[model samples]
Every structure is written in structure tokens, then in C-alpha cells.
Target: MTGKRGRPSVSEALARDERVVDVVIALLTGDGIEALTFDRVAAEAHVAKRTLYGVFGDRTGLVRAAIRRQHAYLGDAGDGSSDLRSASRAILLHLLGDEAVGIHRAIIAAAALHPSLAQEFYDEGPGRAQGFLASHLRAEAAVSPELLFAALLGEPHRRRLLGLAGPPTPEEVDAQVDAVLRTFGLLR
Candidate 1:
């Protein structure tokens, strides 16, 4: 990811770009936003500074790209029956993972300094994740799947983000899922 160099050969750019983003995420998780700079990221990523600038245009762009990369872990679309509790559980777990938590923190910290960047990250990331999850719930509809989705995808996760709670344990997740099922009359 050495960003210090001029343009790489076409084939090398894709891999370098990925490495740059990966290095940025690693740096972000280790140190908060204040500690990041193009020079530091170039050193950390092992890329030439010039190359980094060529790809991202500026430090702000790099920050945006890195945040976008972390959030993009949630996929574009999903296809699963809402009735399939196991699949639903997996999605919930992914959202609450430590890595996801780190990304969420970085975005929040960055947002305090840069509102536009935060907005871009939200539009590119969480909104997409919610839409993908919403679509899956739509597929799962035995009936009133949105209600189930709302419960499963709602307060608990955001409450975790607000530092009001940590990720729920598997037992707790099961209870939450079960509550959704009972409320929707999916469980006997």
C-alpha cells in the first residue's frame, strides 16, 4: 500500500488500494481519528505517499474510503426467510462484532470533527445495511415481517452503539429473537 510512489501499474493498483484501506482500518482501530495523517497512514500501509494521494485525492477522501470499507462488510442484499431464525441470528452477530464496534466508534469520533464525512459514511454504510436486512425480513414474512424486523434490528443494537450496553450474549440474542417470534405469533 506504499502511497509514496507515482501511479502503479494498472494491475497493481487494485491490490494496493485494498491494502491501503486495510491498513487505514487497522490504524483506526488501534488509534482514534486524531492520530491519523496521510504520512502516518502511508507509513503504516507501506505505500508511497504520492500513490495514496493519487488514489484518494486527499486525507479526507482516504478517511471516507477507510470508513466506507469497514462499513461495507455488511453486504448489499440478502435473501433469507424471516422465519429462519438461524440466519437472522448470524446477521445480528455480525453487526455486534468487535470489529464492527471499532468501526462504529471511529465513525462517531470522526463525525464530531467532520459532519459531512459522517453523513457520507452513514449514507454509504448503515442505511445500506438496514435496507439489506429489511429486504431479508420482507422475504421471511409468514406475516407482518416488518414488525419482526423492527424488533430484531431495532433498539438493542443502537443502544449498544450509544454505550448504554455491550453486545448481547448468545443467550440474550436468543431471547430477543424468541420474543420477536412470539410477538409475531411465529412461535407456538
Candidate 2:
């Protein structure tokens, strides 16, 4: 018999995991998060359920990993937000838009009854994004950006995503950025 094959490279492993997350996100966007069962994801990604389990541990694990992966796409840690006033509107609307919003709602809903998953979402999302905005303000604009960042963070936007309200228009989003910029003394 042939000797055991060598372990896969890190990039190979991550490529596999990334594809799974991509399929999950696409499915979530198309079918809704509640419909993204392992079976469905397996069929979509052309992988076995056993493979999903092996890579992500379980359903929650899969979701958390998928969310965390997508979360990086929107991560603000290194990217500049100096143009945040203009970009914020696009970013916020997009964040609260169709592709990103469902997973946010699903994770938040999941987190409500599940502490571990909640913590995971917090770490990957609000915890990181809000903090990055705060740091950006401190470094590029002003001091004590905490309040403004918090105000800019969540709520009605998320509400809009879950059929609780409507999406913010460009005018609304711009008004919010103006308000936040004023708070940071970046604008009048």
C-alpha cells in the first residue's frame, strides 16, 4: 500500500474552507440563513456533509466560521476610513444590505440563545468594526471617538434587514455620516 499522503498545505486547506464559506454565504443570500443547513451547503459546494463537519465541527461551527470569513471582507482594521464620511454611507448601506445582512441577523439570533456563538459574532463583527472606527478617529481625526462609533454602529439598520423596517436611502445614510463627523469635529 502507498504510504500515507502528506498533509495538505495551509493555503490548500484555507482555499477549501474559503470555498465552503463562499457557498454558504451565496446560499444564505439566496435562500435565507435558516435554509443553509449542512445538507444544502454540501449539495451546493459539492462536498460531503462529513467534510463539512470535519472542517467546521458542526452547524454552529460552520456558521461561525462562515461569518468570520465574510466578516474579514468588511474588516476595517487596516483599510483607511479617512474617506469614511462618504464611504460610510456606502459601507453601512452595504453592510445592512442584502448580502451581508442575513448572516448578521442569523448570527445575532443564534447568539441570543447561544452564548458561545454570540461571543464569536461579537469578536468578529461589532467588537472589531466599532473598535476599528474608534481607532481610526483617534489616529486620523479626533480623540474619544467611542460615542460616535457606537452611534454609527447598529440598530435601525439591522432592524431594516429583518423586515422590521426599510433600507436607508443615500440621503439618510449621508445625514448619519454628517452627524457622526460633526460629533468628531470633522465637520460643522
Candidate 3:
């Protein structure tokens, strides 16, 4: 019997996409974005180059898809809680996590040469996180969500990027989250 002419079943397609993104993330973390090529991704992902082209079109599209996949946790609404502090802590935790730190380093290094990727990263990663936090904050708060996020990340994030320190421990993340929230008057 003949089968569908185009694409696999939805489940299979999703699984393939997930695998591709996972491979991309691993490459980015291990070798930085400069080393992430479609050829390499296809070889490692065990998907045909044509399949990657069909799903992602090109290197940029594949990188963007990978970034979007990594940002999925940031896109999630937490516990349906209205508390800004809770939201802030969740955002900080995700942002400071090991995977996020690695992706951030890759994006920053990639963006130095590819300016367009900077905008894409901002829109999809930090921009989304900022919007999420802003939605949970009081309108009258003097601090902007962007600044709040920066404060939450602070020097530790920079240190991580520079290979001067490892990903912050959960206690460190909570402390920094509290400090930033307190500074912004989001926490009592």
C-alpha cells in the first residue's frame, strides 16, 4: 500500500525535530555556535541533510529552532501563581541554569559575528523572559523587567560566560533572585 507523500506522522516529525534540536544544543554547548553546521547536525542527528532542509530550511533556521526549543522553559507559565516574586525566582532559576548559561555563551559568541542572531536571541530568549516578568510585576514598580533580569543575572552570569565560575547553585540562585526582587520592591 502507498503511504503519504510528504512528511512523517506528526509524532514522528516532532520527535525528529526534538532530536535535531537536542543535537544542535549539544554541539553549541560542546563546541560553540561556530561549529554548528547543518552537515554536522545531520550526521550527528542521523537525519538526512534534505530532511533538515525540509524542516529548518538552512543553518540560521536550524539555530533559531534550537534556540526556541531551549527557551521553552522560559515560555512556560509557572504554577498559575500571581506572585511576582515567585515568577521572578522561576525566571532567574531558568536563566541561571547550566543549559541556559551554555546557550547564552554560544549566542553571545555567535552574535558578535552575526548581528541578526543577536536580535533573534533577544526576541526569543531574554525578551520573552522579560515580558513574562513584566506581566507579573506591578505597573508602579520603578524597575523595568529588563533591568530586573540583569540584576538577577549580575556578575555570576558574567563569570559563568567567562569560564571564571560554574553555573550558580540553587541556593545562590535563590539568594540572587531574592536580592533582585528586594531591590525592585517585588519582594517584602
Q: Of the candidates shown, which would achieve the greatest TM-score relative to the real structure?
A: 3
- For each candidate in turn, the TM-score is 0.66, 0.67, 0.86
TM-score of 3: 0.86
> Distance (Å) between predicted and true CA of 32, model 3?
2.1
lDDT of each: 0.68, 0.66, 0.79
Model 2 regions lying over 4 Å from their true place: 1-19, 26-36, 69-76, 79-91, 139-146, 162-164, 169-171
Q: By the lDDT metric, which is better: model 2 or model 3?
A: 3
Model 2 TM-score (2 dp): 0.67
| CA shift of 108, model 2, Å | 3.3
Report the lDDT tens digits of candidate 2 across residue range 130-164.
Answer: 66555455466654545555566457564766678
lDDT of 3 by residue, 41-131 (tens): 9999988899999889877787788767655655555445547766777766676667777878888888879888778778878888788
Q: How big is the positional error of residue 113 in model 2, measured in Å on the Cα after superposition?
A: 3.2
Residue pairs of candidate 3 with colliding backbone atoms: none
Off by over 4 Å in 3: 1-6, 77-82
Query: Over all chains combined, what TM-score does candidate 1 have?
Result: 0.66
Tens-place lDDT digits, model 1, residues 115-135: 876787676655665565556
Clashes of each: 11, 0, 0
